[model samples]
Target: MPDTPGDAHQSLRDLVYVQLRERIIEGEYPAGRRLVERELAETMNVSRVPVREAMQRLEQEGFLTVQARRGAVVAEFGPAEAEHFFAVRESLEALAAQLAAQHATPAGLKSLERILTRTRKAAEAGRLRETVSLNADFHRAIVELSGNPLLQDMMAPLDGRLRRLFRLTSGPESTSPMCTEHEQLLAAIRSRDPQAAADLARRHVAGTRAFALSALGS
Candidate 1:
């Protein structure tokens, strides 16, 4: 069957959703910044219909909040929200690390090692953004290595929020410490020590939570 207008717009909607989500997560569209449908449509050379659909999807994902006056504004993370996020994150991360230790194969371990190698290089090069992105990749990789489809499914939705949180806490001073913690966690997984891996994961999340809360003045 020939593609209809709806089919075309669906593809455009996904593209717009991805682009807007990336911008929001990267802090280009800071919290409280209103996103105008018409403006974005014009900028991206797309129709308002697709832009609107993309915004609605982002809103469902907690990256944007729509209001009567504000239309769509980037979501903010306050103390309460931060606490709730960290609570869930710590649990999931600990579980992922433990499972990864139990299930990781030699190939899976090597994949994580590659991510760590790139992360270390990025940190050493003083590439803050790349380092932060690699940090998120490392965590996601560990989750994948858990070998449980259910656990992977659970972590999927939080990818964007996790990246945002990482961006918030990342800095020149953070790169080294983050690299060290990741290295230790990976080593635990390599050693097939589920308890050690889980403990390291919990501590890692706890450390990031404290830093995020302190920076947020929470």
Candidate 2:
């Protein structure tokens, strides 16, 4: 086992990757912003090697574009790609929700209920970022409750992209609508209605997709 939690080597890479990724998602880097390796190395207080490695990894992960002489730049979202990603995510998340509804334990449902309460409060308090994070946590907990490791693996990458998109679309007014959708999703899952749960999950992602598309001017 790795000394550090959550895949040590990958965690190191992810630490750098997440900071850079969040910067891009938060619009600090913006689209087509040039990434300077040495500058980032200095700012992050790490060697250029890790920065370069992180940049290459991010590029492979679709958050950046690597140019021969120009180095790396933040990747721009094209409308078609965004739509396609969301469509696939909707299908996968709906399946996950259905499985969760079928398999959720009493304890799992209770935990989900608690998460919903916290998420609702976060949204009400206008903590958009925290609400977005809790939203991901709520969905991840459902996926874990499904007891399907393969399904969890399939959803992880898409979840990362969704987080980025959420950050992109985040505003004061965005939280309430999302909170309402989450409430509906939890209601279906708590009822143990797989079809309803699946439908609600799909609708939630679809709504987010529409919101992100509009925000991206797609």
Candidate 3:
């Protein structure tokens, strides 16, 4: 059902949203870049209505800042915002690792393995965008394995921002270390070592934060 044709009918606004968001996150539309509805509409070969809707949604999601006459510009997060985001990630991801270690079933572990395998392959193939998405999914799989609905909901929004940050800084070397850490973290979870898993998760998040902050010039 999820892959059905009915489910594939993404609206023009949704399509515009995805393209614009990707551009912003990838720095194709860098910080403070003005988002002109007419220009975007013409470039995307779409109507202004969808581009306007996409801009509104992106503004609400902190990817764009709308002004009275200046229209919308790409949003920029300063050091404080970066620090706050990383702190939130550190705590919640640690909790996720702990819960996953304590609650992961055989099937869940298998799913995590699948995600990790795909992630490694994407990284090795030089698919940075795919690797970023898979990296988020890999983390999401572990968080979902925690068997906590609230925790899953809490992580959903954060994953997008995490992807943007990860894509900005993570290169080939970063991918290898990240994959190695994920492998060791999965091993800890499989062994049911809650403390080890949680510690490793926190460390991973901290490392990402450090890289993100440095890359942002914060």
Candidate 4:
């Protein structure tokens, strides 16, 4: 059967959803910023219908919240929510690291090493945005190495939320420590030491949580 217009439209909406979601998480749309369907549709060169669908998708993803009269605003993270989010993420990432250490292929380690190198360069160059992207890539590579689709799926949402928080607080001081942690994670993976990898991952995430809380004055 030929692809219907509806299918094409859904694909377009999904694409729009991804773009808008990233912008929101990157703080381009900052907390309490309203997303107007017409404006977004015009900006993205798509129809209002697709923009609406994209907005709804982001809202469901917890990146946005629809108010009774305020329209759609970017979601805000509070101290409590931030604490819980990072705590849960720390646990999950520890498990992912342990699994990856046991299962990571040579190719996966190489990919992670490449990303780590790129991340270090980005941090040194003061390219905060690129550093954030590379940081995400490094963790994603490790998650994929775990050989658990379900665990990867579970990590996806947490990763997105964590990226948003990171972007909000990332600076020269923050990036340096993060770069060092990434190197340690890579070294652990290279040694194929599951316990060390898990310990390092946990400490890395905990450090981030503390940094984020301090920056947020929480």
CA RMSD of all predictions: 2.0, 3.0, 3.5, 2.0
The local distance difference test score of model 4 is: 0.86
Q: What is the lDDT, from 0 to 100, of the residue 205 in candidate 2?
A: 85
For 4-96, candidate 1 gives per-residue lDDT tens digits of 977777788889999999999898999899999999999999989889989999998889998887788999976677898989999999999
Return the candidate ranking by lDDT, descending.
1, 3, 4, 2
Return whichever of 2 and 3 wins on lDDT.
3
lDDT of 3 by residue, 60-131 (tens): 777899877887998776566689889899999999999999999999999999999999999899898788
lDDT-better candidate, 1 vs 3: 1
Model 4: CA > 4 A from native: 1-3
Q: Which candidate is the best by TM-score?
A: 1
User: Between prediction 1 and prediction 4, which has the larger lDDT?
Assistant: 1
**Sorted on TM-score, highest at the top, how do the candidates line up?**
1, 4, 2, 3
**Candidate 3 residue pairs in backbone clash:** none
lDDT of 4 by residue, 51-153 (tens): 9988887877788898989899898876676898887889889999999999999988889888888888989999989998788788888999999999999
Error of 1 at 36 (Å): 1.5
Clashes per prediction?
0, 0, 0, 0
In order, candidate lDDTs are 0.91, 0.83, 0.87, 0.86
TM-score for all models, in order of appearance:
0.93, 0.87, 0.83, 0.93
